[model samples]
Target: MKKKCISGLVMLLCVMLVSTSVLFAAGSKESGASNEVDKIKSRGVLNVGVKVDVPGFGYKDISTGANVGFETDLARQIAKVILGDASKVSFTPVTAKTRGPLLDTGELDIVIATFTVTEERKLSYEFSTIYYTDAVSLLVKKSGGYKSLKDLDGKTIGVAQSATTKAVLETEAKNQGITLKFSEYASYPELKVALDSGRIDSFSVDRAILMGYVEDSSEILPDKYSPQEYGAAMKKGNLALLSVVNSTIADLDASGELLAMKAKWGLDK
Candidate 1:
């Protein structure tokens, strides 16, 4: 009977150990499953990366000292959905080259600055559903006699650094049996300055963004190539925030609010 009692106590201890392990694992999972949404909510603000130079997308208004435009408004919408207030957002200016690294370092919560989505980029970051679509085009001085991509055969085309424009133009140039040289600038304004100063024969970027840079001396060519899809981007593994962002975009799109917003900014075209 004493031996039987010892076995019973040992079995009880064994069962307790197993149960404790199961409980610990459950607790660990619950802790590990914590999402970024909770953090953003705690912070009470949505930090977004945007462009300050691209006029209709996300730019600082000189007269009003306000960050205004389509993408800026989009960030506000996300802020409203997440924080219950449209004004609870802070905008950080980002360029094509810096946005990704900033995201990696956790400096920005979301990027809404005309961030083009690609398969390769998807590997490094989480992108929301395509919010806008555009075709890559060329902007050149009107006096350059540039009617299409064919005109700048051996000349240099200026593109924003870390943008998809160069690859896009190269593919089209190859298809048209043309060899083109490319100069990469850090910002659209610099590219525009380069074009204006005869440093580059053309300024190339998405048509919508290029529209913001067009000057009296420059004209966007009639040729369009490679449809670019813009989406809000976040850090890799940020599934929680991504889901909310995607849902917000879907809800706004369904309500036709986004279409109207685009129209308000003359982007409905």
Candidate 2:
């Protein structure tokens, strides 16, 4: 009888020990997550990924050596909304190919680069409400007289490989019966330089990007450019974070803070 009682006590102790261990493990996980949150909150900093090469939108200022552009200002605004200090943001320059992986691996908290919103991208990353809208525009030399996609038949048109813009352009070109000789590159820098050097007849990208180049260039084509909308990118399933971002965007829109900021950055033009 004493042996039975001893065994029963041992079993109860074992069960209690197991329960305590499990509780500790779960508590540790929660604690770790809470610590991460607190770290971000305490520092009032948000790490945002942005494009470095795109001029007038995400370029480094030649004089001050600071990142200045429309998207940069927008990122700063987002940081101010979440962290209470627009200057608290740390910028991480990422290319189009690296943005998704960096955000996926937790290297970037938000992507405020020239990211376009699309149905296919909705499957992977979460996008904040559209902030700026433009269309996909084709830039050609003034001498080329390439007015539309229909004019690009058998001509080399530069585009970025793996870019959503490329796919959209290709689809539209196909639908419109425009046959283009695609010259693919990994980054916009390559494509733009190629276009400027007359390596390709034209290049297709966001209208804002083309305008940035046109504004800085001495001689650009007299052709009409198109436009597209840009959105902030974030990790999927981050409903709380996305909600906060969306709310902030709404407030900015309603208060005309967005327009004011745009004007400040010359994006309102």
Candidate 3:
């Protein structure tokens, strides 16, 4: 009888021990789990990807050595909304090809780098509503006598990799009965160099981006096509952060601050 009692007590203790361990394990997991917004808040600084080369949108100001532009300002606004301080944000310069991979690696919390929203991209990442609209345009040297895209038939045009310009222009070329050859560059500065060195007859990308590279020697051809809508992007399943971003953009637009910011950077045109 005593042995039976002892065995029963041992079983009860074992059950209690197992229950305690299960509770402890669950508690550890619950304590460790945090959503996207909580992670950003815990860090106290928002990390964003931006373009360092495109002026009026994102660029490094030489005198200040600070990034300044419409999109940079947007990042600050987003940081302020999320972290309660505008200055508590960091920028990682990203190009067309690097932005997606950076965002995929969890190195960046968000991308404010003139990311164009497309049906194809929505499959990979979550994007905010369109914050800015622009059209793909061309920049050609005046000496080339290239009056329009149609004039550049059989001529090679420079385009940025991972941008929609090349595809849109190809369709336009087909419609206009002109065949265009394209040379892809990783950056706008490189494309400009290609144009300057006679390797490419024209530089083509979003007009807002092209504006920064235009010079006394080159002019943006009066051709614009395929409206591109810019949106901020984050990895899929970051709905907590995406909700905040989308709401912040809506508030900015509703308050007319978005337009004012655009005008401040001469982007309202």
Best by TM-score: 1
For model 3, residues 1-269, the per-residue Cα lDDT tens digits are: 99999999999999999999999987665454336788999899999999998989999999999999999999999999989999999999999999999999999999999999999999999999899999999999989988999999999999999888899999999999999999999999899999999999999999989998888999998898999999999987777788899899999999999999999998999
Instruction: Look at candidate 1 and tell me the lDDT of residue 171.
Output: 90
lDDT of each: 0.91, 0.77, 0.92
lDDT of 2: 0.77
TM-score of each: 0.89, 0.79, 0.87
| Alpha-carbon shift of residue 210 in model 2 (angstroms) | 0.3
Better of 1 and 2 by TM-score: 1
State residue 264's C-alpha deviation in candidate 1, in Å: 1.1
Give a tens-digit lDDT track for model 2, residues 1-269: 99999999999999999999999998886676455445667867888899887876788887998888878888887778777888988999988788999999987878988888888888999899999886677777766766666777778878776666666666777777877777788777787789878898887777667766663342333433334567898887655567667888899899998888778666776
Backbone clashes, each candidate: 0, 4, 0
Worst 10 residues of 2 by lDDT: 215-224
Q: Could you say which candidate leads in lDDT?
A: 3
Candidate 2 global TM-score: 0.79
For model 1 the TM-score comes to 0.89
Q: Candidate 2: list runs displaced more than 4 Å.
A: 1-39, 215-227
TM-score of 3: 0.87
Q: Which stretches of candidate 3 lie over 4 Å from their true place?
A: 1-34
> Which model is ahead, 1 or 3, in terms of lDDT?
3
